[model samples]
Target chain A: MKNFIFQNPTKLVFGKGQIEKLSELIPLDVNLLITYGGGSVTKNGVYDQVKKALKGRSYTEFWGIEPNPRVETLRRAIALGKVKEINYILAVGGGSVLDGTKLIAAGIVSDKDAWEIVLSGVAENQIPFASVMTVPATGSEMNGGAVITREETHEKFSFGGDYPQFSILDPEVTYSLSDHQIACGLADAYTHVLEQYMTTTGQSRIMDRWAEGLLLSIIEIAPKIKESPNDYELMADYMLSATLALNDFIRMGISQDWATHQIGHELTALHGITHGHSLAIVMPGTLRELKVQKHDKLLQYGERIFNITEGTEEVRVNKAIEKTEEFYRSLGLTTRLSEENVGEDTIETIARRFNDRGVAYGENRNVTGDVAREILRKCI
Target chain B: MKNFIFQNPTKLVFGKGQIEKLSELIPLDVNLLITYGGGSVTKNGVYDQVKKALKGRSYTEFWGIEPNPRVETLRRAIALGKVKEINYILAVGGGSVLDGTKLIAAGIVSDKDAWEIVLSGVAENQIPFASVMTVPATGSEMNGGAVITREETHEKFSFGGDYPQFSILDPEVTYSLSDHQIACGLADAYTHVLEQYMTTTGQSRIMDRWAEGLLLSIIEIAPKIKESPNDYELMADYMLSATLALNDFIRMGISQDWATHQIGHELTALHGITHGHSLAIVMPGTLRELKVQKHDKLLQYGERIFNITEGTEEVRVNKAIEKTEEFYRSLGLTTRLSEENVGEDTIETIARRFNDRGVAYGENRNVTGDVAREILRKCI
Candidate 1:
């Protein structure tokens, strides 16, 4: 196992009516800024709950943080935070809003531009921030990483920063989510585990089992959630699984392959696909393209997660990749580029972008521009 | 699932050569007190490493915190800390030394005596403390709970307090551990997971899977570790599993049955058994006695961990309990009170103590003194 240092200090306030904890979670003296996305919280009663919880508390509000949280949008929140002298932020929406708030928190305290912070790949300093996490897809509630898009440049990049001081995850709020949102969330979480797990085997047995455990849980709940999305227990599993998936819990002392996420980010940046849906489309392709490199781990994953133990090694790897795409399809996501109307032009652009940056991705750092193009071509 | 608020802020610095990070991990400007056990570290070269890492830094050293960590020994450390005005503590031994330091940290800051703080069941305030953990069991390095024994009274009790600021866990330290110590550590970790997991089923699927994940990892590594005790990867798995097993990572929003631990502590206090060995002897008995309450979970554990399927419910439950005892025995620890030479008098003493204390344990709060007696009888 490789050497690693791990620490996550996010206080997770989870379960029913945890939203009421907002008043106490955030400190009383700080000048607060509550950030939100486009008005879903209003329809879902989350807004009312949050307001009632912090009754008589004075705070500035910043709304309109969009999906795939753009740096263009977050600059405005940072400006508003600067004017309000907001020392702390409470993000009250989905991953995008929280991701945007992360940038705002950094931008508020620094002279660097919001986009410049994203480009820097690490936020040196940030105002304190917490969240009333209404969505579970990106795991922004607990992790320090945030992906921000530059709309004009069609670029999406992630930056690491301070974790939330606290996150209130009331899974009951998810009862109002659309089926498509739920599907995308499940896909995102599954792909998150795969990113950490589908690497070289024998690094750490506990990590492998944990990554597989989350995969098994996500696979089991994806179907049941479709039938009973309002079931408190099912949604709780989904919410917790998403948070634990990418919160640095399962990647301890292990090699990780995030090539699929890098490709998926391009899909989201160029074609405006949902982050998780893009992963559902691209992850299978990456697996197929890099099957030989990931062969042993794939065989183990196939046997444990997909129960594909009866086949030959080559056949089992293929079956595992097929089963992965099928799992996404089972969640009502289209797992092909053509199905989403994303063609060769977009794929070539992503390849050229990778080439321009002179970068290689994945566990072994071999997924260069040509490899990316090949992977995308397979998806097509 | 239950409503819960969870947070752990201990930064885990793991892998080889991590002890050198002490200079950077601990602050420069503090009166630091370094605590130690009965000089195992001195023979193991850990003492030399720690001394080299903190060279040119002046600090007080308190030695001779024995196994199970007594309040008597800790009071001397506390008095020394108070005299030196120590604000920071770096415990450089196993769990017992760290556990003792936790109390000393609390006692130095409060007017109450160390034993009073232990009986209070919670330490309201404690000076900051970190650890260079040399043992793989107890998980005191990463958790907020500590078990301290009162040698004079033959009493053992636990208290909740602040987590370590950081913990350096280099699995290479395990190379110096005796075979019996390794066996006890493995059994301790395995039982820790069961205490959290072998309760109600369906409280949280992710929690169950994660718990099972740890269990499976421990089981798979136990025998391999016995053969290859010096293997870095196997020992790393063992070390990491022990930390993760009790670090509040698995018990989120779930009921836990610590009845085995409660009963095991009595065995330790009365007969002077090692903490982990006592658990090995008591855990299977707890399972056998409470199998009816833990029916579904036992069956699930049976199927998942031991693959004990194809039987009636009672048969499966019995097989699971038997397999649990067998696992402990395979670790080279005795799983019966009689094997340890304890008999009816000790059982009655434990029962009388529990009855006098008016304490009922386990998930349902029904493991009263009578139930404790029955469980002890099963062990016999």
Candidate 2:
């Protein structure tokens, strides 16, 4: 167990019709900017509910933040926010909007360019922001990290900032989501827990159990959610699981491996794959390539999450990796690179990027550029 | 799932040698009052570490807050705090001391009488406070709820107040705890999870899995801890389990049953038994008496925690209850009132107390005075 400090102050207002809390959750006197992505909230009734709640309250709206939350798009939002003297940000769509808004919030109050903030990898000052979270992926609603992309350069990077002042998560808003979005969301959430859990075994027993619990939950609810997407109980579990996965709740005093996510981001950046589906493809590859290094935890994860106890050590590890890929495929996603039309060029590009950055990731800091290339080739 | 607003802002500084952070964690400008229990910290070297960290800081120490944390002792601390014009509190001992300091924090700032505040059952305003937690029980470190007793009247009650500003939990500090204290702490953490769980079935599967994860972790670690109490990893898990059990993380949008805790409080108040040990005695009894109402959850608990899947529903439920009692006994705590030298007179007294208050507890509010009496008799 490592010495660490943990604090998250995002007030989660969850359940049906919780968007109405927006009026009370935000201060009325603050000049507010409600941010959105491609106007999905307008179709889903979330915008109407938010408008109804903020009736007569003075606020501006910033729309058309893209799926990957591009830096160029957020620069315009920041300029609009600066011109409007916006003091608070309310992100009204999915993770992309919230992720963009986080950058916009920081850029509004700082002289630093939005891209500079992303390059620095952290934002120290930000206008207070809250969310009417319409998606259960990325966990941007409760966490302090945001991934922003540069369309021109084909790069994506995450920056840390203040958490939302509050997040209203009404699960019913997810009823209209496309099947691919739902599949990507589930994969993202499951991979989030795995990123934090599949590292250094025996650090903390309770943390291991908790991480396994979230993984098991995502696995159990994934199929049931496909059968009945609007089932209140099923979506409720999914919403809760997504938030819990990245909310600093399960990673206490433990080593974590985000190598899969680091690789997945490159896939999203270079080839425009959806964030969660990229993880669905890359996580199995990372596991298969690193199975020996993560042997014990993979065995425990296999037994606890997949009931794969009747196998030799190597067999169990292989089965765990196979079951992981199968789980993602079960969610209507392809876990192989070639199936997605991605090839060696993108892999080499990502490897060159890691090499240029002179960086290593994962718990042991051994997932270097060459290692990432190996994992991607395994995926191919 | 229910509509809920969740926020806890306590900064948890966890792991090895975290107490050294106190010098930087607490602000030097505040008038700080350091509170403690009956000098166990002095013997354990925690007091010296705290004093060394706070050498140049202006602070005063208040000692002798006993087990269960009586209002009588708290009033003295409150009076002293008022005299010192203390605006910050740092509780340096176990949960008892921290619990008493919670009242002191509320009382020093309020015009209401100390007992009146307790009778009101909630403190809306409190001076900022933090803790250097030396015990792995009660979870007062990360939550806003505190259980305080009135020795004069033999009454115990809980009140809601400000969460700690920060808490430092160094697992090494728990190495000196007695076998009995360790047993009681483990029991307290386990029952805390059950109180939040063991209620309505299928409301939230993620929450259920999280609760079960804590239960399984405790069950798996309890015996290992008995053998190696000073093992850093085991104690880290134990400490984290206690904090997470009651930290509002697992109870989101879920029904909770604290009937066992309600009855157990009376046992602590009347018989002077340790609070957690009392719960260990009474919880199995509560399960036995309310098995019909909690049948589904009991079966799930049995299957998940104890693996009691080879029986009929009724048989499985009974076995779960029996296994719960057996686990407590294995922790070297008595699971029956008679074994602890209490009898029918005490049970009737508790029943009368509940009846006088006209209070009902549990998820369904059915654990009335008579039900409590029945539960206590079962414990006997």
DockQ, every prediction? 0.92, 0.87
lDDT of 2 at B172: 95
For model 2, residues A15-111, the per-residue Cα lDDT tens digits are: 9988887888899789999998998888999989999999999889888999999999999999999999999999988899999999999999999
Q: Residue-wise lDDT of candidate 1 within B1-380, one digit each (tens)? A: 89999899999999999999999999999999999999999999999999999999999999999999999999999999999999999999989999999999999999998999999999999999999999999999999999999999999999999999999999999999999999999989999999999998989888898899999999999999989999999999999999999999999999998999999999999999999999999999898888889899999999999999887999999999999999999999988888989999999999999999998999999989899999999999
Q: Tell how far residue A195 is off in model 1, in angstroms.
A: 0.4
TM-score of chain A of each: 0.99, 0.99
Error of 1 at B237 (Å): 0.2
- True-vs-predicted CA distance for residue A156, candidate 2, Å: 0.6
Chain B TM (all candidates)? 0.99, 0.99
Docking class of 2: high
Checking candidate 1 for backbone clashes, the offending pairs are none
TM-score of 2: 0.99
Stretches of candidate 2 off by over 4 Å are: none
Residue A254 in candidate 1, Cα distance off native in Å: 0.4
